[model samples]
Target: MHLVIGGAYQGKLEYAKEKFNIKDEDVFTCTESGDLPQGSKCLYRLELFTLSCVRRGIDPCGAFSDIGAWSGCVIICEDIFCGVVPLDPLAREWREATGRLLNKLSPEACSVTRIFCGIPQKLK
Candidate 1:
């Protein structure tokens, strides 16, 4: 499974659909009220609240990263949350989680993955 996570209106879902050719029916919007869709191997709009605690430096009891590890899913978390100040506890936690996930996935991949922080169009 390939996960693409982002805030509302960030185009993460759209990019996944377009870039990966995923159908609408294949997308599962994880929410407190909605049950996980049947046979939906892919999750689309995962509730931000599920991961919001990490932003506050409080880790969620069971996070998607844990699920991803078990399921061998590739997760792409984009602009999930950003901090105004450098060296913030929340920022450190986020970085640590990301690093752990990446290391778990492939520790030998030494190439740097550049993260562009700018207007989306600037990517082109």
Candidate 2:
């Protein structure tokens, strides 16, 4: 999988689309339900998916145990763990879990890119 991470409004999805030649039909925008389209070429809003898993008391990593399924995918997640920490326990846990999930996937990713102000920086 290729990982694309950045803060909100950083153009991560746009960059992915340009780089991967992705089409609207090939992208799956995740929601607060832990629902992942295994066949989608681009998985966006992954942070929200983690929040859904946390709310459901489910291990998000378990859903991605099969690396082969994502081997050729582009995964985009927001960097929600930055700046001020949330006071709510649920928010904190969600942030931490998202960080852990990204860390776990980073090394395994075919490439890891971080977007900042519309600029893409390769990290892996």
TM-scores, all models, native as reference: 0.44, 0.96
Ten contiguous residues minimizing lDDT sum, candidate 1: 110-119
| Model 1 per-residue lDDT at 5 | 42
Count clashing residue pairs per candidate: 0, 0
Question: What Cα-based lDDT does every candidate model obtain?
Answer: 0.45, 0.91
By lDDT, the best candidate is: 2
lDDT of 1: 0.45
lDDT of 1 by residue, 3-109 (tens): 44444466666666665577777666654333333345455444433335455444433454344432532234444445454467655665555545444433322
**Maximum-TM-score candidate:** 2
lDDT of 1 at 36: 37
Candidate 2 C-alpha lDDT tens digits along 1-124: 8999999999999999999999988899999985787767999999999999999988788778987888989999999976798989999889988888998899899999999999999998
